[model samples]
Target: DIDPELKQTYDVMNRLRETIKNRDWPNYNQAFHPLQGCSEEMLAALQTLAAHHDEIGNTFTHHYTNGPLEGSNNKIKVIKRTGFGYRNFFRFRLRVLFAFRVHTKRALITK
Candidate 1:
């Protein structure tokens, strides 16, 4: 038997999928209409996006979360204190990117 939480998530996913499959256009403030004739193509694209969403969501949940990024920002503050602050935001950004490239690459590989 599926857990209650998983069942709820599946229901929500199905609703969203149906909405995408049926919607005439990406409009706002109206109920989405079923595309009617293009169900196959619509559903195929939607299913592909859903699968990618699940993959990315799983990666975000299991690794490379915002927690570590925030922690590194805190650590950067300490580094700034010692280095008398990085006045060039671009250089600072590159430094951070370079430092984290290995970890990000590993995460992408594992994912």
Candidate 2:
């Protein structure tokens, strides 16, 4: 079995994660209010989480995310690195745009 302290810490953190995911403030407060003398690492983490409580709450309140935008940026950066052989800057730009702008499926024609 894990050390009791470690197990307690894990239980507390797991409860915290579930409360955050569910946006249950009452449960979160119950789980978080007793962090007085946990291990030093947990204390530090608690401080960080306390400082960002509003931001963390905001995170759970919104379903929107910048994940897709970050993915697109990563794709563009990779293309930029490997596209040096393009004849010109505009041509390279076009290639990148085409990669993103092209339709995966053609439209049906019914005349």
Candidate 3:
């Protein structure tokens, strides 16, 4: 059997995940309060999450998200890494633009 403390920690984590997934902002505090003395490490993680709770909840409150912006950033990073030999800033900028243009064209054609 697993240790009692470990089981408690897992239970708390599962509840937190459920609360976030459901966007139950009203019961967020109640969901998290039980973690207060579960374990020092768990409590510390909980504290950090609580500190950024608003930013976290913003995902639920706002219909829009920065997912596309983050995907674009990842694509740019890939292009830069794969074409690491390019030394000119202008050339790099053009390459990024070209890559994006190709991507857009493919997306439009597939639609």
Candidate 4:
């Protein structure tokens, strides 16, 4: 059998996941407060989360994320890696532009 403390820790983590998944902002404090004494690592994480409580809670209020920008960044990384890096910044910029232009054209054609 697992240790009692470890089981409790798992329970807390599961509850926290459920709280976030359900966007239960009002019960966030109740869910998180118990972690302050769960373990040193959990306590430290709790402190950090408390510090950014507003931002964390904002996820429930806002339905947007930086997904598109992150996707673009990933694409740029792939381009840079595949080309083995570029010596000229202007050429790199043009390549990035060209890549996106081709992507857009292909998307339009497929539609």
- The lowest-lDDT stretch of 10 consecutive residues in candidate 3 is 102-111
Clashes of 3: 0
Top TM-score hit:
2
lDDT for model 1: 0.53
The sequence of per-residue lDDT tens digits that candidate 4 reaches over residues 1-111 is 357667667778888889898999887768875653376676677789889999998898899999999999999999999989898776787788788885564434421
Ranking of all candidate structures by their TM-score, best first: 2, 3, 4, 1
Query: What's model 2's lDDT at 104?
Result: 36
lDDT of 2 at 63: 73
Instruction: Go through the candidates in order and give each one's C-alpha lDDT.
Output: 0.53, 0.76, 0.79, 0.78
Q: How close is candidate 4 to the true structure, as a TM-score?
A: 0.69
Weakest lDDT window of 10 consecutive positions for candidate 2: 102-111
- Report the C-alpha lDDT of model 3 over 7-106, residue by residue, as the tens digit: 7888898888888888887777677877643777888888898899888788768889889999999999999899976888767777777878755644
Candidate 2 lDDT, 1-111, residue by residue in tens = 457777767777898989987888778878887664467788788889889988877776777888999999999888988876776766676667677985433321111
User: What's the distance in Å from true for residue 20, model 1?
Assistant: 42
lDDT of 1 by residue, 15-70 (tens): 66565455422321122233333345555655576568655445534645588878
Q: What's every prediction's RMSD, in angstroms?
A: 15.0, 5.8, 5.7, 5.5
- Candidate 1 regions exceeding 4 Å error are 1-67, 102-111
Q: List the residue pairs that clash in candidate 3.
A: none
